[model samples]
Target chain A: MHPAPSVIIFTALSGLGFGLMAWLGFGLPAVSGWSAFTFFFVAYALAVGGLVASTFHLGNPKRAIKAFSQWRSSWLSREGVLAIVSLLVIAVYAIGVIFLNQRWQIAGWAGALLSLGTVFTTSMIYAQMKTVPRWNTPLTPVLFFLYALAGGALLAGQTGAAIMLLIVLCSVQVLAWVLGENSFARAGHTIETATGLGNLGRVRLLESPHSGPNYLLKEMVYIVGRKHAHKLRVIAIFLMGLVPVAILTLLPTNHYMAAIAVLSHMAGLFVSRWLFFAQAEHVVGLYYDKR
Target chain B: MTSLPQSTQKKLGLAIDLDTCVGCHACVISCKEWNTSNYGSPLSDMDAYGAEPSGTFLNRIHTYEAKTLERAAQVVHFPKSCLHCEDAPCVTVCPTGASYKRSEDGIVLVNEDDCMGCGLCAWACPYGAREMDVAEGVMKKCTLCVDRIYNENIPEEDRVPSCVRTCPAGARHFGDFADPDSNVSILSAERGGFALMAEQGTNPVNRYLPPRPKADISGSGQIGVPATALGEETGGAKGFLSWLDKALEKI
Candidate 1:
């Protein structure tokens, strides 16, 4: 909930990178030589850069390699594994397309599916968090997938795909916002439920356990200013969805407009992602009446 | 393995009696004193003596006012730590397999050596029980005093967790909940000990005893009439002179 800049960067950049790779795997831009090499280079740099950025937030980044071992149960591990697998597959596909001048349809399809799957796994890393009710919903994955696909389409200069995805993702983003707002407003747990004291008519926080902030308080009790959050959400929606759609529709296929759309959507999504973490209300926070 | 066992051999946990707890915070201090030195990290403090002190700890006592009626209110001090759940999200959500629940004793523990302290397990915990030690760069939590509970170096009688040992009101309990005959199991059955945040489906092993009915605080201790009133002889006295005389004589 602290909205660590590294995590924000990782999610935004990687989603776009993977999105582009998925499209590129399909041979969408249909190019070769230096042109194809540049595309592949940009995709790999973003995807890998985002992955590496994630480790910077870890308490011990040197041991991050160990995270790959727990894929059986952990979504976070699944995400790590999937990201690596996708990256590797994308690498092979990139080589085939650039060097061999071969689409290798099956490998392309495989890479595309895996790239999408990696993004899905990454979404689940947050979506599976039952503690944060705002994140523990199907809409979270939907919102993420839409962002990836839409962001990717825009980067590849696929005007039709970008416009279509932008339309759908904008609607989904609205729904996500609505659901997120209602998550805490209509949460099942309260101070009484949190404390296992439902029999008590009404429970209220009288005194906090500690005089100073502790780990839980710092990490879990993140409270964003309501008015500020509202203003930011409006800004995010306008920048990420509305403006991009407007730009793509108005300009149709202008190179500069496409670039503008990509950058605007990225900035917008970053702000929204920040709010996603900042606004998340962990059920445990109910005990502290944070919700 | 990160995957959970089908069933654990034991479910060791604590049952705190909210009824008798006087909120002395003895358990809090004792836990810190024992765990800071014995556990993985020293529970480092940042600006401990400054204007804003902060630190890491596994257990915390939350105080609340339960108002049954406008005039009837009870103060509740809740002591919370990891429940070591049967379906612990913390254990399953761990990326590095550092967080695990033991199949033998059911004590949730952090293998600090393997932990990268990504804090994802902490994010998954609905109880807010997991703590990240800033100094060690690893997650820490209530091991149920695993190091002391089974340590042969310690006296047999002192084998319980520190919080249970130092609870001044004897409100904190530690035992094998898997045993139907254990004190915690019996207490849970008798007093209707309930799990915290049951809807979360963690199936918490730890429980809290509901607040028992309190005796009426009104009427019972009030005196109807004073048997030896000093003012009896000065009832007809005028002004403050006689009233002061009667009060002084009584004193």
Candidate 2:
């Protein structure tokens, strides 16, 4: 893919925001008074910041009002609408936790569901593009949701709160990675099918009309070597998954180690997100001159 | 607007015979000539006489040589353009509804006046059929000679697309795909026609028949060395020179 910065930032930042919300929604009930209020505020702020970052992706921000209109058919439009709805719900929950003691429980539950809904909408943006077999899978949404939880846990650790939550988040992250890796391989199979080529057969580019790189080739045919990709995948799994969980478990009392683990996890998720876009082989790649 | 009488409109399309296409680029030139003059916008040439010349052509022929020692080398000329898909991704993905499918004939078309130069439709299309007209700031593609085909001034026989009519080798055929008896449909059925990237599920209307084996050009099957010239030996240089002189005298 063309490495659309808007989409990349949106997915990554939103994952962190939603992940934090998921953790806070689940964690707030156990805490009391000032501690709970602080967690809720931080989580709400992250969600809002993520949403703000996503708006930068729009070509014409003025036309963003029209985005909510096409939710009936377009996943992109649905994502925009749902994301706004999620933000509103999160805001309500934050207010409830701060001022309305009796309604905090109900508002927190609503926020959690809305957070998941936002992640689902985000994943659907790419999943709806049936032409791109790599993104057209149920695993996409699942992976997005898990990444959010993983990111939130890492963030909580950095803030010197919720070591146990971090462990749970990292565990889910490992599961997500395993599932995503399997789905990623399956997606490659779909690309082969899209090009009408068998697994065993060699499909070489025999001819290309254009001498220089065209939009299709530049956008779809991203070339990453097997060794480099494999190494990155391992690093991503470790940094985004196991390492954070280990750090949170081993040094539960050490706030500094917890913070480093969280930062490393964020950096790792960024690499994971980059690999997600880079590793995907769109069916249009078959048309490229270089395979 | 006058409403036509209710009826089942047939979808017309082209079925190209790849086996017979000689890669002459006749169809490409003919399509360019017809569409440039009559379609939504002209396919302009950027630098006609300059060192680096480029232009928007509705149709293009790509030659592929499948290298295999067992079958020698075979050249497959693929004449590519708009397939006019039934479920065209470009049409549905267009935010402005500028790109649309014709209910009458399933032909995907763009309204130049409505197009916002967003280039989303171009991205949605996998075939790379759509090209932006830099001068007009609108997308241009093969209309399948829409103007020529529906022109009332032309005769019924001549109204069947300029590219099909101009093909010297009869490689291109245009007709209603809905009619089983249509020439295009019959040819497709007989030739085991295949749609390019059918898995994309755009349901492209156009089909291409695979190339046939080359039997006539390889000449007689002689393994290696040439056979002894008739029965005459003429072994020595003096005898060979005499035979050569005699052969030259006869010529």
Candidate 3:
């Protein structure tokens, strides 16, 4: 995988945004009027802005409206539909809290569920790919859900929830990496199987189809990012999991310290998301004798 | 719709003969040439004449060296394109209904007009058959020369895919696999043709005939030089030359 910046930013920011929206819908802060407006504004901005950023990677952003049509079969379509529905539902609930100074409990619950559903659909976009064995496991959804939950908690200022979720998120992150190590091999894709030449012998790529790069090589055969994956993993875990947990636990509870913790967690998330895409080894790479 | 039809009327695909392919890449070139001018949009190139050149290609040739302890190494030239699988993942993964397999002919195609170029379809394909055209901003693939195959504008003899028609080694064959008596089906049955990456469960329509094993020629007297009895009837060279002659005899 190429670890495309647009996709990385889209997933990270949208997951955080939707996560925060879920917490807000649950009335975690239980604010009304100006405070409620502030919370809803930030949540909407993050969620909507991330969705717009996702369009940046599309070659024809003008035609993106058509992407909502195939939800029956396409996870990406489901994500788009769920995202819009979630945003619209949250907007109605936000109106009640911010303007009416009343909690529409039923709408809030529905919005929260829809918000989480949006994130789940987003995660499924990658998890459904049999071509990328490393991401094809149930752990992909688990990791995405945890990141959203922990990031949401951090943004929502739920100190206890944030600390606990971060701990669990870190453990799962480690477990995912450990299990993902042999995922490509375990998938049983090799040059021999890829070419159906196993009966003949061990297959090795003698020559490539072209002298230069092509779309497949550029998009799926990326290998440069994995060189520093080990170092990046430690950095990601420390910044994402440890830093926020340490600050929230050790420091006296204050707005300034909480803000720092939130910032640190978001930054860590960006790096973690980058690694998530960079380290995924696509089965197509086997045909090129890569991965 | 992105959802595939329950069944296609005809499974039209290629049967590639690995034994006959000589790695010439004529099919690759022919496909690029014919498709660029005829398809929905031209297949584009980036810095084609510059330092690093790349272009979209519907078909490509990959050469591999296979070795076994029991047999000599074999170089197989593998040509790959869209397999047009019975359960095409690329179709189902498209967020838009732009990608679809025809119920009438079973040929998978992209409606470039509806394509947003999200590229999820390319990611879903295990064979790396679909490519995003840098210029067109839409996915390009082996249509199996859909335009040519169905067009009456072209000559009757030129109705096959450009790659199949242009292949110099006659390694490529095109027909309906749905009909058991079709040329492609008969060839597959006769040559023990097998699908690529069957474990993936794509159930590809295309099949590849494995290369025939190379004949062993070692110790055949015709190829190996007869060992001479040196220093028996004829006087052999002494010193370094004598040692070289002894080594040659051992070989």
Candidate 4:
């Protein structure tokens, strides 16, 4: 995986946005009128803006509408449909709360569930890929869900829940990194298996098909330097998880401190997302003797 | 619509012979030439003449060496293309209904008109068969020469994939595997043709015939016989030159 900037931005931003939406729908802050308007405005901006950024990486972004057609079989299609439906549902709920100061608990809950479902579908788009063994796990969705919930709790200014969620998130994030390191080899994909020549002997690629890099090699056979990946992982955990938790735990509750905490978490989330794509080893690399 | 068909009338595919292929890359070039002109979109090249040139190709040849403790190392030229599996992950993973497998002949294809070029299909494929054309911004892959195989305009004899037709070694065989008596089916049965990455459970229609065991001559007495015989001939010439030098010294 190339860790395209568009996708890193999309997943990180949208995950936070949808998490915030879910919290708002639950009336965590119990905001109304102008406050409700402000919250909804930020949620929509993050969620919708992330969705728009995702299209930038598409080869033909104009035909993205057709992406909603195969929701029955494709997680990507499901993500698209769910994002739009959840956004609409949350929009309606937001209108009622902002305009009339009405708090319909049932509608709010439904919108909240739908918003979370949108994030789940987004995670599935990557998790469903058996070709990338590192991502082909229950842990992928779990990590994604935890990240959303923790980010949401922090953004909604629920310090108590944010501290707890961040602790769980950081622990799971560490666990995922440790487990993911060996998942590719554990999947039993080797050059021998790739070519079905194991019986003959130890198989090794002597020459690639082309002299220059092709689309497959460029997209799937990315090699992140081990030293850089380790450093980035440390930085990501420090900023994304540790900083937010430390800030909320040590400092007194204030608007400025909360803003700092949110910014730190989001920046960390961006780096983690980058590592998520970069470290994934697609099975296709075996043919090229990579990974 | 991205779901696969229950059954295809014909499992049309290629059976490539690793033992016979010389890795001349004739099929690779011929496939590029025929597919670019005949397919929906021409295979595009980015910076073709520049320092970094890359082009979309339907078929490619990879060379590998297989070594064992008992047997000497053997070089095998492996040609790879779309397998058009019964359970194609690529087709099902397409967000748009652009990628599909035909029930008629089991050929996997992309409807470029509906393609969003999100490239999820390419990621799903384990064999790296699908390529996103840089110029067209659409997924391109081996169609098994859909345009040529059934085209009435071309000669009946020419009604096959360009790779198969141009294979100088006759290593590439194209036919329906569904029929028990087809050339591809019989060849696969006799040659122990196997699928690449069978653990993926794609149930690929295409098959590869493994390279035959190479003959061993390491222990044979004839290994250095030629060199020994040449050495004796050279020794005789040296002896005659020494005798001539002695006669000249006496004169």
Fnat per predicted structure, each in turn = 0.86, 0.09, 0.87, 0.82
Taking all chains together, each candidate's TM-score versus the true structure is: 0.92, 0.73, 0.94, 0.94
Give residue A116's error in model 2 in angstroms: 1.1
What is the per-residue lDDT of model 3 for residues A1-291, given as tens digits with 9 covering 90 to 100? Answer: 998888998999999999999999998988889988888888888888899999999989999999999999999999999999999998889999999987998889999999999999999999999999999999999998999899999989899999999999999999999999999889988888999998888999999999999999989988886889999999899999999999999999998998889888888899889888889988888889987
TM-score of 4: 0.94
Q: Poorest 10 consecutive residues of model 1 chain A by lDDT?
A: A218-227
lDDT of each: 0.85, 0.65, 0.92, 0.91
- Full ranking by TM-score: 3, 4, 1, 2
lDDT of 1 at B241: 79
Give the candidates in order of DockQ, highest first: 3, 4, 1, 2
Candidate 3 error regions (>4 Å): B219-251
Q: Candidate 4 chain B: worst 10 consecutive residues by lDDT? A: B228-237
Instruction: Report the C-alpha lDDT of model 3 over B110-192, residue by residue, as the tens digit.
Output: 99999999999999999999999999899999998998988899899899999999998899999999999999999999999
Worst 10 residues of 3 chain A by lDDT: A282-291
lDDT of 4 by residue, B34-130 (tens): 9899778899998899999999999999999987766667899999999999999998989899999999999999999999889999999999999
Please, what are the lDDT tens digits per residue for candidate 2 over residues B37-150?
Answer: 886778777666776656777677765554433333555666778888777777665544456677687677777766655454665676767766656666777787778788
Q: Give candidate 1 regions above 4 Å deviation.
A: A185-187, B217-251
Standalone chain B TM-score for every prediction: 0.85, 0.81, 0.87, 0.87
- Give the TM-score between model 3's chain B and the true chain B: 0.87
Worst-scoring 10-residue span by lDDT in model 3 chain B: B222-231
